[model samples]
Target: MELSSLKFYNVIVLGFAFMLMFTGFQTCGMVEQTVLKSYRNDSIVNGTVTYNGDGYTSLAIIYVVFAFANWLAPSVVSVLGNKFSMVAGGITYTLYLSSFIKPITATLYIGSVLIGFGAADKQRIPLYIGLTSVCALGTALLLILRSHPIQKLEVGDPEEDQPSEEEEETSDEAAMLNDSLDVTHRLSWKLFLTRDMMILSITFFYTGLELTFFSGVYSTCVGATERFGEDSDKLVGLTGIMIGVGEILGGALFGIFGKKTIRYGRDPIVLMGGAIHMVTFLLIFLNIPDLAPLNKTPDSAYITPNTYLAVACGFLLGFADACFNTQCYSIIGTSYPDNSAPAFALFKFEQSLAAAIGFAYSSHLVLKWQLLILVIFAVAGVVAFFVVERKVRSRAEPSGSSYRNI
Candidate 1:
């Protein structure tokens, strides 16, 4: 919030930190594909029957838990503050990851918890500012939990910020009156319900779906490949490597060029990202078809979308997706152009909720119908593209006066 913190070098440092920090967690950004990894490992340890049924349902449950957890994160953070939330995330992550080395049932349950904890990590990414903001907070919270006991942060008395018991009733009455008085709000609900936010939400949702597919589902499938006569943990590891690389490249590209494109405005980058995402989804989805036996030949089976191709898709999306996400956040947080908590809160809420919806839908669809989930992602991509052009930019009426609506 300080002017000095917004300096160019500070911006660069902050951006750099975000990338480095993410490199460690390697955020499952479309990491659902990695489900293939755990599935493979579990099959090896516990045998093949684990892979026989709708194991994909487990992935779906993981996602649903993550979405629900993340949806509640902001409200939790509001009560607990960034400091406590970070601590909680770290503890949850450690517990989740710890389950991996344990018994079969423990691993799945632990991973699910970790996924939910990780969702909070996603929600809090945009709120904190300064150097290495995301990682610093993530590390601080998680590390403290691992290293030390859960002594609560002395975040001042909650009552300090709240109305007294007597005043609470009066405040509630005032809120009721305010609600009754405003039938048609002076501002367009459209401003509050602007197309840009909706567009960003849709695009980000697809991003979430792609992420979950890799991190959650693909790993499961890859792990279970032996059921279909292909067993390669090395292949699964390579998949993990691909995801890490994609996220770093994607984030770095965004940090480097996102601002430069901001002057011409954020719309171009968003649309370009959407188009690329559509192609990427098609490419990945095409892999499934290519895997079909009919597509195979004696000398060399028809190759599915390569890991490199998927990684490249993620990298490009990072570059393009950053513009829309960043612009949308800035618009909501600063639209009022003043110290209005509601303005920023609305923006933060949107980001968290969209992520939740995206994760949930992606998980559910992938379970209900496997590769077909890509079509849903495609539809979201198109929606983002259409919303930006048809609903958003086209509907705007130019005004001579520039008024801050915060």
Candidate 2:
């Protein structure tokens, strides 16, 4: 009955609901490139090409549209309010999943666009129907969630000053309008020109770039390597599962030790994540054939493709990715608590744009070149993050206190 307890319960329920939905959604994303690519290759071989699309193209479209959707999400959320906005968003997923049943290229592309909307945030029974059913359940749960509690001032409390109901309603409406205007202003050129935003954008962009790789491209490379044997297709799913495991582990650790980690600040965690990613990239370069990114390849890299290595890399990639994301969320929230909507919108915009570009080139670039690009961005991103963090800390320091290096 207590507000805090009710809030915690809501969060827990929401977490579980999302877990169920994303379990299906993320699994599909992980395997989509491989599955679609295989279908295309097979069709070509058989001369029966009904669908001419590949997963890379589909993912590229999703992220590019997702980038644009970020600009519209705030207005959509403001108009619909948070809860209904989520339900509306959830329905998009169901529609996306439904498109998979017959798998027409047009439908798939349309579904990709719809899902991109959902994701900036669908299904089929056929095997996809099961995924759709799971997601629908999650949406159902969202529909039932209690809206967040509104706190009322108690008489005799220091902040107990209260206004008449009509006055309060007018004030609240004014505040809402002002907040919306503030978000819009911040999302404009002013925020983009800030030194902090510019620097942080690099890290944000890299996160998206790296995100596309592990979530989509890496699995495709794994599936395409013939050296891994006919079971390479199976390995794609397994690699995805391992990545999910690592992500869960990292999330659990960060959630548990979050307060403690704050003592040392976010940069250390980000640096550690970047280091892990660099190592993972090195291993991929050594372990996967260069041609793996373009198509199914009959060759091996310097090291023969070992199932264990692929799985381990996936785990490391996922774990490191969690580190970057969690830290980025913290940094943005702390830096722009007053204007978090625009800040987050900018973050998603940059991230999605980078992801779109990465996926666009996924089919064209070799594994080595992709790895090199990741490394270059990783280094630049880390440096930029450090610079912005220092500036933020400097600003946060008390007027008379010595600035302690993080």
**TM-score of structure candidate 2:** 0.87
**lDDT, candidate 2, 219-315, per-residue tens:** 9889889999868877888888889888888877665666666576778888999999989999998899999877788998998889999999999
Query: Candidate 2: deviation at residue 177, Å?
Result: 4.4
What clash pairs does model 2 have?
A: 93-122, 94-122, 97-122, 97-123, 98-123, 124-128, 124-129, 125-129
Mark the regions of model 2 whose C-alpha exceeds 4 Å error after superposition.
42-48, 117-126, 148-183, 397-406
- Positional deviation of 12 in candidate 1, in angstroms? 12
TM-score, model 1 to reference: 0.56
Top model by TM-score, which number?
2
In model 1, what lDDT does residue 372 have? 62
